[model samples]
Target: MRELSFHGVTVRFGAGRSALAAVDGVDLTVPAGSVVGLVGESGSGKSTLAKAAVGLVPTTDGEIRLDGAPLRARRDRRRLQMVFQDPYASLDPRMTIGASIAEAVPGRPGRTGRAAEVARLLELVDLDPSRAGSLPSGLSGGQRQRVALARALAAEPDVVLADEITSALDVSVQGSVLNLVRDLRRQLGLTMLFISHNLAVVRYVSDVIAVMYLGRIVEAGPAAEVLTSPRHPYTRTLLDAAPRFGVALDDPVPADSELLDDEPPSPHDPPPGCRFHRRCPIGPLTVPERTVCVEKDPQPAAADRPHRAACHFASDAAPASLEVPAR
Candidate 1:
C-alpha cells in the first residue's frame, strides 16, 4: 500500500483576475491502506481535487506525491486510478464489459491471460463473469458501477480515488454499492480517497473524515471524533442538516447553530480571511471574539495533532446536540 499526499496543492482555472481557485492549497494525506473521506457541499472543490490527483485537471501550484515522491511520470500515474460518479458515462457503451476491463490491464498479456484476469476482477466485484461479454447498456446502474470498479482494479493500482461513486445510483442500490466498497477495502487492503457530499454515507465507509469548504479543508480527524465532536461550525451545520430518524419535530435546534441559508461565496473570487465567516453560525456574526475570523485567515492545526480544525476557535467545545449516532 502506497500513501498519496497532496502538499499545498492548488488547482486554478483560467488566468489573471478571473481565475478560479477550485482547489486551493489543499494539504491532505491518504495513509497507506486506509480510506479517507472527503465531504462537503456542491461547489466545494471535492471533485476538482480528485480530478487533479489523476491528471484530469492541472494544478496551478503545489505537488501531488505518491509514496513520498512527486507523482509526474505517466507510468507512475497508473499506480493511482479513479472510479467516477456516473457509471454509464464512464464506461464505453460499445465495448463489452470484458473488453473494457481487459483494456486497463497493464502489459500486453495474451488473450487467454487477459480473459482470465477480467473474469477474476468481475467475480471480485461480485459480478457474474459471464456478464463480462455484455455491453454496459445491458447492465443496471448498480451493475455498471461494479464493472467500473472492476476495470479500475484491473490496473492493479495502489490507490483508488472514488468520486461520489454512490450518489448517482438509486437510493435502494446505494447501500449495496457502499457495502461493496467496504468489502473491497478489507479484502484487498485498498487505499482510497472517497469523495462525497452525504455526511451519512461518508460516515458509513470512512475511517477518517476531512471536511472541505470553499476549496480548503476546514476540519479533518478520525471519523468517530469528527462526527461525534465536530469542531468547525461548518462541520456542525452539515451534521445538523442530515436527516435524523426518531427525532421529534419539536426537538429544539441548538442555539446559534443554524447554518446561514445564503449560497457560499464564489470560488472565482473567494472572500479574504476565513472564506466561511460570512456563513459561520458561531463566527463574527454571533461572537465578538470571532471577529478575528474576518481579519485573519486561520491556519490548519500543527502537524502533530491528529484531529485538526482550521478555525481560531477550534478548541471551543461543540454542542452536545451536534453528535451524530454511530452507524
Candidate 2:
C-alpha cells in the first residue's frame, strides 16, 4: 500500500576531515493518502531526511523510489513538494504570495489556471485569496505558514514533505493548519510525509508514525498504537516527553529538565554498536536487528502484526513509559 520507498538511504556532509553523516541508512515506506509522521528531537536527522527526499541534500548512499520507479534516477522536480519549518524564511520577501504560489507552476497553462488554484488553496488553508498580494512581513506567523502551504500546493505534487510545518506557530493556530492538511489529504488523495518533533502533532495528522532517533526509524506503527503503546525506549522517551492533560508521560526532566537530551552522536563517529544504545532505555534486540544493534543498526520488527519496532525483544519488550492514565 505504500507508494513511496527509501532503500538504505544515507547522507553525509563536509570534507574528509569535517565530514558528518546527517541521515544514515534509513528504509521506509509511505502509503498513498496516508500521513506518515517522522518525530525526533532537534538534530535527530528528521529534517535532513526530509531534505534528502526532496534532493535538498546529496545522499551519501541509499535510494528513493516513488510509485515503484526510481526517484534518484529522474529529475521530476515538480512531482514532490517540500514545505520547510520556518514559513517566513522559506518564502520570498519581494514576491506577492500569489506569485510565490504561482511560481511553482510552469508554462502558459500554469499561468492561466493559477487564479482558480490560488482560490482553492486559500479555502483549503482558510486564507482569503484577496491577501495574495500581501507580503510575508505583513502576515502573522500562522498566516505566513499557511501561505507556505499554499505555495507548496501550487505544484500539485503527488507527495508533500512537510518538515515541522507547525513548530513555528502558536499552538492554537497549529490545529487549524493541521486540519486543513488532513482535509486536503482527503480531497486530493495525497501521500504526505508530515515530519515533526512533537509527537502530539504527528499523532493528530499522521495515519502511521515512524519514530526517528539518530537518523534511524526505531519504531513505527499506527499513530494510536505507537503513541499509546510504544515498544522502543527512544519512543517511550519521546511519548513521555509530550505534555498530555492527564497523563504523566513527563519525560525524565532534562539537565535543565529539558525532557529529552542525548546529543546525537556524530554520524562520522557514531557508536560502534547501536547508534541509539547510548540513549535507548530498552534492552531487547534481534541478532540481525541488532546485528549491529549494539554496534550495528536494527531492522523494524513486527510486534502487533502490521505494527513494528526495531528491537531484539520486539515480541516481548515492555511498551515505552507514558504519563497517560491506562484506560
Candidate 3:
C-alpha cells in the first residue's frame, strides 16, 4: 500500500471572472493501509476532489503525491483505481462480468489464464465464480456493486477511490457492502479514500474522517473524535441531520437547530468570509463572539483537542452544543 497526499490542491472550471472553484485548497492525507472518509452534502466538492486524486479532473494548483513522490503527468494505471457511485452505470452492458474484470486486470494473460484470474477476483469480493457468465443486468444491485469492486481490484491498486459506492443500496445490502470493503482493506492492506454524504456509513468504515463544506475541509481527525466531539458547527449539523433508526420520521426536529434546514451557499459565487455564515445558527446573528465568522475567512487551525476546524468559534463551543434534542 502507498500513502496518498493532497497538498493545496485546487480545481476550477470556466475562464477568468467567470471561473468557479469546484475544489479549493484541499490538503489531506491517507496513510498507507488505512481508510480516510471524506463526507459532505451534495456539491460540497468532495467528488471533485476525488476526481482530482485519480487524475479524472485537472487541478489548477498544487500537487497530489503517492508515497511522497509527486504524481507525474503519466502514471501507472494499476497503481490507483476509482470505483464510481452507480454500479449499473459503471458496468458494461454488453459484456459479461468475467469479461469486464479480465479487461481491467494488469498484464497480459491467455484466454484460459484470464478466466481463472477473473474467478479469483470475484471470490475476493464475496461473489460466486459462476456469476462470471452473468451480465450486469442479471445481478442484484449489491452483486453488481461487488463486481464493480472486483474489477477495480483486478488492477491490484495501491489506493482505491470509492465515491458513494453504497449510497444506492438497501439498508441491509449497504451493511454487507461496507463489510466487504472493510474486509478487503484488511486482507489486501489497501489504502482508500471513501467519499459519501452518509455520515453514518463513513463513521462505520473510516479510521479518520474529513468534513467538507463549500469546497473546503472544515474538520478532520480520528473518526470517533470528529463524529462525537466535532469542533466545527457544520460537522455537528451533519451529524444532527443523519436519521436515527428508531426515531420516527414525524418526530419533531429541534426548532432552533441549524441542521437539515438551510441549503448550502451557491458555489458559483461563494460568500466572503465564512461560506457557512449565512446559514450558521451560531454566527454573529446568534452569538456574540461569532462576529468574526462574517468578517474574515477562517483557515483550518488546531482546536483544543486533536482535530482541526475552520471555524473561529470552535474553541469556544463545547462538543455537546450539537447534541440531538430529545424528541
Q: In model 3, how large is the Cα lDDT of residue 107?
A: 82
TM-scores of all models? 0.94, 0.85, 0.92
Error of 1 at 4 (Å): 0.5
lDDT of 2 by residue, 52-149 (tens): 78878888898888887778544564577899889989999998888888777655555558887777787777899899778889999889988888
Candidate 2: lDDT over CA atoms? 0.74
- Ordered list by TM-score, greatest first: 1, 3, 2
Ranking by lDDT: 1, 3, 2
Q: CA lDDT, every prediction? A: 0.87, 0.74, 0.85
- TM-score-wise, the better of 2 and 3 is 3
Best-fitting candidate, scored by TM-score: 1
Candidate 1's TM-score reads 0.94
> On a 0 to 100 scale, what is the lDDT of residue 309 in model 1?
78
